[model samples]
Target: MSALPCPCGSGSPYRDCCGPLLRGESPAATAEALMRSRYTAYVRRDEAYLLRTWEASHRPAALEMDDDAWLGLEVLATEAGGADDREGIVVFVARYQDQAGVVAEVRERSRFARQAGEWLYVDGETHP
Candidate 1:
């Protein structure tokens, strides 16, 4: 079977992008990669993966995946979130449709930290 496109908008097959990360087979190498995998996790409604990748300080007790349908993800920019960086930032936009079919978008500048060779999501600043 052919691989599906990654929801992270990475233009690569899921197996080559976020699939491994989501499956706990590999850790995200960079902050941007971690951000992309997080986006994919949202699309797949993989709450466990989300929680695992989240920083302990910011991780919520649980995630609720209701009726909202995630449509797409767009990565806008990145700063200092390379393989060797301890800290990184990623700006992105996520689009979704609610129960009423109303389209909505959330833009955010997210922070990430690398600890013990793993990238963890810290927090995000949502854009109005």
Candidate 2:
């Protein structure tokens, strides 16, 4: 079977895109890349991957995956968060449908920090 397309909308096969990151085979090279992988983790309900990439200061003790059907991801903007930058910001919108059949979009400006050459999600500010 043809490899499924990456849920991160990277136009690449899952194995070539976020799959490696989720499987702990590779580390994201940039903050934007890490953000995309995190979204993919949500889509697949890979809570372990999500927690592993989250900054320890903000990392939750556990993740509770909701019954949201992830539809798509659209990266709107990015600041810094490059391979060499220690800090960065990414603004994006994620669309999903809840179990109750209500569709909604989450617009967020996320913060990321690179430490020991690994990008970690710090937090985000959601928009209404």
Candidate 3:
């Protein structure tokens, strides 16, 4: 059977894109890559991967996956989230439909940090 497309909308197979990362088979090469994987985790309701990739300082005690159905992701811009950078920023808009059938978009400027050769999500500032 063929693998489904990655929920991150990377135009690549899930196995080729976020599957390995979600499975802990490989680490994300860049901050944006980490961000993409996190979005995929949300779609799959993989709470473990979400917590694992979150920075320790900012990681919550636990996560509760919501009922919203993730529709798509749009990466608007990125700054310095490269393999050689310690810190980077990614601005994106994620769309979803809630249980009540309300469609909405979440726009955020997320910050990521690379530590011990691994990229971790730090935090994000949501835009209105």
Candidate 4:
């Protein structure tokens, strides 16, 4: 079986791929970068970064993470692109261990919004 690219593939090395974005680089010219950074946020458990990117209406008091768990991301797809008004649609599955040391998966279709001149994570649909 062929191994899948990093959860936020974007066809680039995980570090160079999402590093720039998480470091404040704009989404990839092709919309892939946005998807990747979102993954990186999960990997690093950057609650502040995640909150800053989330739209206010949906923003939570704080983002949560399993302190003892490590997370990885895989970006399945991204669609709806544009330079004026970009929309990043990413399918990702996050893998991590729970308090009991059981491995688990979280699948979601995330929606992103770029308001004014910044790309922000909006919300998503969870499946499984």
- How large is the C-alpha RMSD of every model relative to the true structure? 1.2, 1.1, 1.0, 4.8
Model 2 regions more than 4 Å off: none
Tens-place lDDT per residue, model 3, 1-128, is: 12889999899999899999999999999999999999999999999999999999999999999989999999999999899999999999999999999999999999999999999999999998
lDDT per residue as tens, model 2, 43-114: 999999999999999999999999899999999999999998999999999999999999999999999999
Worst 10 residues of 4 by lDDT: 1-10
Identify the runs in model 3 with alpha carbons over 4 angstroms from their true place: none
Q: Give candidate 4 misplaced runs (Cα > 4 Å).
A: 1-15, 25-31, 82-85
Q: Rank the candidates by lDDT, best first.
A: 2, 3, 1, 4
Candidate 3, 16: how far from true, in Å?
A: 0.5
Give the alpha carbon lDDT tens digit for every residue of 1-128 in model 1.
Answer: 11988888888999999999999999999999999999888888899999999999999999888778889998899999898899999999999999999999999999999999889999999997
TM-score of 1: 0.95
Per-candidate TM vs. native? Answer: 0.95, 0.97, 0.97, 0.73
lDDT of 2: 0.96
Which residue pairs show backbone clashes in model 3?
A: none
Alpha carbon lDDT of each predicted model: 0.92, 0.96, 0.95, 0.66
Over the stretch 1-128, how does candidate 4's per-residue lDDT look in tens digits?
12334446456565566666666654445344565666667767777667776778888997667564645666676676456666777677878787888888888888877776667777889999
